[model samples]
Target: MSRRTRRHITPLITAAGAAGAVLLSATAATAHVRVIGDVIPGKPATLQFRVPSELAEATTVRITVEVPKDLMVTSVPKLDGWNQETLPGAGGKGTRLVWTAEQGHEIQPAQSETFRANVGPIPDRYSLTFNTEQTYSNGTAVAWNQPRTGAEEPEFPAPVLVVDPEAGPPPGSAGGAQQPGTSASAPAPSVDAATPQPAAAEDSDSDSSLPLVALIGAGAAVAAALAAAVLRRRGARDGSHL
Candidate 1:
């Protein structure tokens, strides 16, 4: 191509490539298992994990989450299609939670499920991380244990929860007793994901509006991603002519 034509086409190609990258990144991110909802530092909170089955042909059959030893998980509410098991930690608190799908209750490809547990009084911290292992029916296991440390996110980042100190009552406040913060002097016991105790009635009413808001936001993202792809294609065609 001529120099003038090449100059015009180069930026178009670059812009197109940038748009395509954003589209792909947004598409891939929806598959990550993520923690949802705010967690107060000093109160019992209902924490939820949204697990999405990423395989096209296989179903997700088992999920195990590593609970930090410093945090205490109280109970897990029963999910309709899964059975819950807990490994006890110090003082009868749960350290690891395992959820296995019942026969024919596996999370099929392109589907997702949510698991909830009562955890707290949360330790005083800025954030918490939960490493998760996902087992597929086809015998493949994917671990979402990689920590995100930089600007770019890890391919399979472990789910993380940010502690909201301002929202909840102060630590050791009445009706909201605080747990001791993680200490360097006293080593914490080795523990995996927090598991639940007895099955308790889940409060569906709390945070009820979040799902609708998330759905709307996700729809907008998908639309933007599609537009990005279209722009990339148009840029490619225009560049080819140049």
Candidate 2:
């Protein structure tokens, strides 16, 4: 190939690789919000929902998460220079939560924000998901409310907290057992040992021992005959002396 062709081809390959990387990053970012910090079952936990601003010219202004029925959200903590509120649900639970930045506090393009909430007595469950809504300064609102499907993630899938079923129980708690909403491990199977049978009961056992038993019986008979002959010879010698 000519030098010109090599140079042009190299640049194209590099550009393609860079574009592929950017596309992959964007695809991953659109999947869902993130849950930050330790998640312990049946105990207090601090959850942070991370949001990213996509459009290079737009600023993110609002974020809201719809809490599930099983979760008990105690409080929505405000970030510095930010506003927050907890909207009541049907059963008086914290159904919808929102966080906003005032005036010049909007999250800019390529920037991110984490909205945190302080809650207590986490449910004994394996996984918890909360649908979310993200709004920009330009009034573009998006929904993150579905599970993943192949390489096409939901435009805004919900945030999730997956609990470790085998995690030890909280301090001062009773048992360190598997949490609810989690699968139970199958138990190990039991086994029985083979029992030994009497020699007379098993044909193979008698055959294996017959040769040894015959040898012992023949040796005992030979020893008895030798002893009798020795005694008789000694008695005849004594009679001759008398």
Candidate 3:
């Protein structure tokens, strides 16, 4: 291959490689479900569903999420331009609530839409599936409708709170078993206030001495330089007189 041809193709190859790397990085960065906030078991917590409007664009007009059956969701706040449908489960219990936010309700491109659900007093750990349907202005629907299988990679992963059994006695409450001569409150450390805290004093003293030492060294250097200059001038004067 000619040097001229190689030089021309080098930059093109480099540019292509860089573009490929950037594309791969962007795909990897966006390839997971992002959950915001801690998912505490048995406690009321707010969860925000963040959808990337960049990839879905105008195509995603509506979003739907399947609430976990185990979690006791007391209320879902009304969102503008969105409709809620609670699907009844067996025995008059509704296990799933589907929230549909359509075209006009859809979040703008490069923007995030948040839906809040109040859930609490759950007995066990459960996974809530967010099954989303994005309908474009072109009558095309893209379903971001995949259930989180616990094993799935997350972008902003919701924390799973582990509820452990309460340990021992409550605060300030005494148990039946008590050792003799032992007080409920632990003894405070005995500090010798009378003892001369020489370490701190020495440190302060050293810090103060450092400046004085530096001043002395500087004065000595200045004195020595002046003495040398005076000697040089005296020798020059004596040589001129001679």
Candidate 4:
């Protein structure tokens, strides 16, 4: 490459690198806490909270999440280096599950933890949102309780689960599938498309209207012509008699 081109390319490369780094940092900041598995509605499912340590100077000491009243949450997975507990919420209905670092163990900078729990009778709803707080050893706590979707998401947006409900039973359970001799039932086809019963009624109505219209028009024309003929015949009889 020419010397001039090299000088211009050097600054462009530096600018691109800087932009990439900013984008990466933004992604990491927004994805600090998220759900790891599918959130099924109307059933108890295993869920995981993916937590990442963001502070470079301190370790993450504790994490708390507000479980919705609709979801029944009780058990937490036994992590080797973490302790879990639940506290009373503002209302008597829900729970605030807290997971703290065990003795001599903390989530260091650039580290992450996956805390699992079986939480639900998940309501049949569109989404599940959890408000969370991540506390650092330096007493800094970051709150993640913001709207899930918009033109611009929050710095630490609340983790949301878009519920997906399948009609069949949960997987891996016995007797959930069709019998060996039977075929799976297809959805009943729409009556209009499959049977075409309504078309007959519509056609009947249309045929009835066409005959009525033609009869009305023919009757009107015959009445008008008959009136003219009567007038002419009356005049001719009167002149012949005179």
Best by lDDT: 1
TM match of model 3 to true structure: 0.42
Candidate 4, pairs of clashing residues: none
Separate clash counts for every candidate: 7, 1, 3, 0
What TM-score would each prediction reach against the true structure? 0.55, 0.54, 0.42, 0.56
lDDT by residue for model 2 (122-208), tens? 787656777777765544555666664334444555676777656544432233334455555665445432544554468887788
Clashing pairs in 3: 59-136, 60-134, 61-135
Instruction: Put down candidate 4 lDDT per residue, 141-210, tens digits, no spaces.
Output: 6677766343455566787766753543433222244545555566756867777588698999999899
Candidate with maximal TM-score: 4
Clashes of 2: 1
Off by over 4 Å in 4: 1-27, 165-242
Instruction: Locate the minimum summed-lDDT window of 10 residues in model 4.
Output: 10-19
lDDT of 4: 0.70
Model 2 clash pairs are 144-156
Cα error of candidate 4 at position 117, Å: 0.9
